[model samples]
Target: MHDEGEPGDPDNKSVNSDPEVQQTLEVVFEEGDIRRRKSSLVPSTAPRPDHRRRKTQCFVHTLLEKHDGVASEDLNASYEGLAQERRVDKDPHSHAEQSQHSRLLTKKQISDMAFGIRELSKKLAQIKIMLHVRNIFILAKAHDETLIKHTRETTDWLLTKDESYRVYVEQTLEKNRLFDADGLLEKNPNYRGRLRFWTNELAAEKPQNFDIVLALGGDGTVLYASWLFQRIVPPVLAFSLGSLGFLTKFDYEQYPQTLSRAFTEGITVSLRLRFEATIMRSQDRENASRDLVEELIGEESEDHHTHRPDGTHNILNEVVVDRGPNPTMSSIELFGDDEHFTTVQADGVCISTPTGSTAYNLAAGGSLCHPDNPVILVTAICAHTLSFRPIILPDTIVLRAGVPYDARTSSWASFDGRERVELNPGDYVTISASRFPFPSVLPLDRKSKDWIDSISRTLHWNGRERQKSFKEWGS
Candidate 1:
């Protein structure tokens, strides 16, 4: 008759009420069963404190066992090795890290590390710069004993100074007594192996074989160097050793220093424009019909088919179309950008680049254009008409000069004062800015300053007596 909550009744008493009874129940239930029963009374999502405590104890026990016999020093070394391996995997090229511990590096050690990094950076820079110049082609004035002697001296100095550099001379020089085996050997015993001979054919075949062209003569020598390289021209360092040394600005005396700077520090270059002159024959017109069709259909015309020249020439100075050996004035029709521009009924016409404006263009009443100006100068060679004047056209224009099919006489064409070709009736010449420009190395001065000095010293431009000062005039 006792209630379930009553402590007096033995059968109705709680399991935890009597000590003997509880002990008997504990023995019967087991610890795991008691825990499960208690856990079932609470929410399943609640954290189990005993489980967390057991995990922590297991982790500590494993950690103690792992490091039970390891020394403190060995533990530090293990950590450092792991860090080093990570660094090596990150950047194989990088140097090892110097500071591993928390202690600050001494000032002297830090300075030494900085100096070592700077030295490494300098070595990398030098390695990058070393690949610039290895082969030098020397083009000196022909039939000049003084220049030849100077060339010998230069070759000797170059050979003695740098054993790595290879010198290339004109093949003709090999036959010359000046560059004979005895002469070369007298200068440098190893010249036979280091010095090489190159012909015009070889130069034409492999223009890129020469890294730099050293021209020792007047401006004409520089032009000859330009002529040798029809496609890509290397940097040309011209020494002033001839008459009218306009293009030859570098002093032969200072060549040692100049060349040294060019090799190491590098020299500034003035990329002068060149003209690709192609002579299109009248008979080729029929062959170009297919190219014309291709052009109409928005396809590029083949260069060899459309504007094939009898002999194409790359001119750095000018191209002249004139009455060669003909008494009558030549009749020439000019076209620009495929549009008819004018007809020249003069002795001849001169087409020159800005670099050549100082040459024939100046003599034909054309303006003195700066070499850097991107313009083509057209000047009449003794024009019959007084009103006809020189004209400057953009470099983008493609100039074509042709003899009319009904013309009286054939016209003559000369490229850079050479390679004279006859343009019969209906024949024409196409002139366009060449993709390959003439790279002329500047002297110690900048492009503008060098040009000014050349005109002042060489051409004696504006050399007339300076205007008297106002005070002098008054006196």
Candidate 2:
């Protein structure tokens, strides 16, 4: 036995040789797997400080309307110029007032700003990746074929150079599976092989199996992607690749490296609150049982009944009851959980969540909200009443809004731009918050703060230019 034990291979690198200290290293670079195909990026606008600017100007205008454009413009320009000088000027003590102004940011505000800045940087990285994802998703349908062609060329280059991508696919889909797992892919390379995350295959396929979805698009893509996953939602990593991205956070260059760390070091996951919606119609009393069942459960189909049911829905944006193409107003009733708060005779009405504040809500003159808040914004599109104004509601109340059909008026109701219903006079529609919140992954650790900060930088919210350009110095 002693003779048979020829010396154990001392040169072996296997973990079994030395259990106390194990080492891991890559053998083959499997980064070549992601094949190249064109993808599409949904259109997105960058965050703007228009709202903040408008508000500030409104404040300025309210206080000094006579000065109008000139005063506000010159004052803002002066602030920007001074702020820039403070930043680049070598001597910190050169301007005592400037130093004091910098100090006025306060410890808490500074801490908050720092946190926001860091988060925004990370988000910018994610946005780049998200844009790539969008290019992959939307390349097929882009209006500009040249842009599509350009993406295809770029993707091919990245596929060859992006080693981390190959690692992602390889590590995610392990080869040499000795054991069997049910309902999993049969080690197929098509699913596991070189998947170029673009075209129809990516648009339809990876969604089923990807570990984390990195949105390389913008806010529109994020919204679209989140809406697709009705159940069993996965985490998303987004990088903005567009000119301006509210949802896209990561930078494009960070892809190869950041994704490397994400795989080797995992990524931070966030839970975004999503709201589900139910649609009900007026004049359908007989199907009330089914309709009511769906109402409580947020089901999709219309509940058919003998009586005309009202049109209402638990919507992500808002339940819109409007008079389409007509110069007439829509007499709509707004019902709270306990009782009807009031009625508004207007062109249309919008009910939205805090998450949707940046969306259609903002367009209708509603306030932007921090993503975490649970509040509803009720705005009148064009109200006939002089006193008609937008109202804020507690998120808890289920808001019922619809034109009274039996009132002998023609009105329409829409949910998230789809599923339209017409309310006959005297009939009514109902709306409320669905039980489910759209759960989206922010990708970065500081998604909310970063989102807010992006609003500042991209929109220049309350903006005094952080710095002065060389051209400005000549001015």
Candidate 3:
């Protein structure tokens, strides 16, 4: 038997030679894995004090003093429970370990993710390829109550028409929505907000986004819509509610098919030319005083005022420089491309685009030119010389008409039969082909054949008693 004080004894207490303490110290120092694990489910406690008591003497003693009833055996049981839970969490077959493995994606998962991305790209390409039809802005004559009523009737009829028409209108309403021109929304409550109203109140608003413009009045209404969109005027489907629907040839009764076809199959769009004219004072090299010019351009030119933001004016038909309140004929000097062309001593001058050939130009004895003709028609309104007739010039050139400073009186210039300005002595008006052109939708059934039909139907062109045949004349 070994003595109790033996130097190499296996049961020495003072020398601290216990195998459990030695094994624990070896695990702590050699493994170097003394980290605290956190868990919400388990109650936390201070670390074990067997090996750490010397290093953390103050902390262990303080805990022992505070919890006087806690025994060493109870603390050992808690530490063992925590260690078992941690070991299970790190086990390869445990639920927590399996969940960690699941987060790491495999090759098959990466391939499936790539395939999903490609399918999404293909679907987006198909969506981009589909044809898109948007909103239709409708314009009706404001002052005419009867015409406004008729327009509302047409809209209501469109909803209750054949299933095709109803579906088209509903889809259009859904995709892009419908809008009424300015004040028409107030008069008709049915359209309230479903069909929005746009006016000058929305300062910067324009009709660029609208796909098409539908006019429910006469040819004048169609012209008004053209003026509304000063830039690129969209295709217009004009319905004739006037005495003679010459320009507005589409019958309101047969609008279901025509409107649908315009929305789907599309129609032949007639590009009608327009002209922009600017009026400048003659004597003043710069510009005349606004008050002086406004006084000279009195209330007589009130009809010419438009809500256009820019001071410059655009005209679809013609500009007439006539002798206004002046007894004498207007002495006008015309220039082509800045070169003096001719001096016309006439009642007035009618500068018209081919689209306006049948307007004031026709009534003034000017030849009717096709709308497709790219020419400017200048006709004299009762000229002094019989030889000075109407002439057609290429649209590529700019024409400037001036009232001579030595003229008998000042002349008045009107645009599209409206917005008139007084041309004082030396005052001149410049005319050129506008960058924007009107896109007019032609009739599907008759197409552009309505031009000659309008001339014969409206003007009764060349209507006369049939000439006697040669056989009847006894030749």
Best by TM-score: 1
Counting clashing residue pairs in each candidate, in order, gives 0, 72, 3
Clashing pairs in 1: none
TM-score of 2: 0.52
For model 3, give the 10-residue run with minimal summed lDDT.
Answer: 21-30
How accurate locally, in lDDT, is each candidate? Answer: 0.67, 0.46, 0.58
Per-prediction TM-score to the true structure, in the order listed: 0.67, 0.52, 0.59
lDDT of 3 by residue, 403-444 (tens): 765677999999888777788876677676664556676765
Error of 3 at 192 (Å): 6.4
Tens digits of per-residue lDDT for model 1 on 1-475?
A: 0112211123421122213221111101122212335546877797877633233457446455534477633344365344322211111112225422111122233223334323332222222122255667899864788877777778777877788677887766776787564677676677667788778887776765666789998888988987988866766889988888778878898989988887776555566778878777654455423322232112432123333336568889999999999999999888764356778999999999989998988888888987867778999988889888899997756677878776889999999998898998767787776645676776534544777777888778888987886655553
What are the RMSDs of all candidates, in order?
A: 34.0, 22.5, 36.9
Candidate 1 structure, TM-score to reference: 0.67
Model 2 lDDT tens row, 216-292: 45565566555544433344556666666765667756666765565454444343434444333444344324332
Better of 1 and 3 by TM-score: 1
- Candidate 2 displacement at residue 325 in angstroms: 2.0
Ranking by TM-score: 1, 3, 2
Worst 10 residues of 1 by lDDT: 21-30
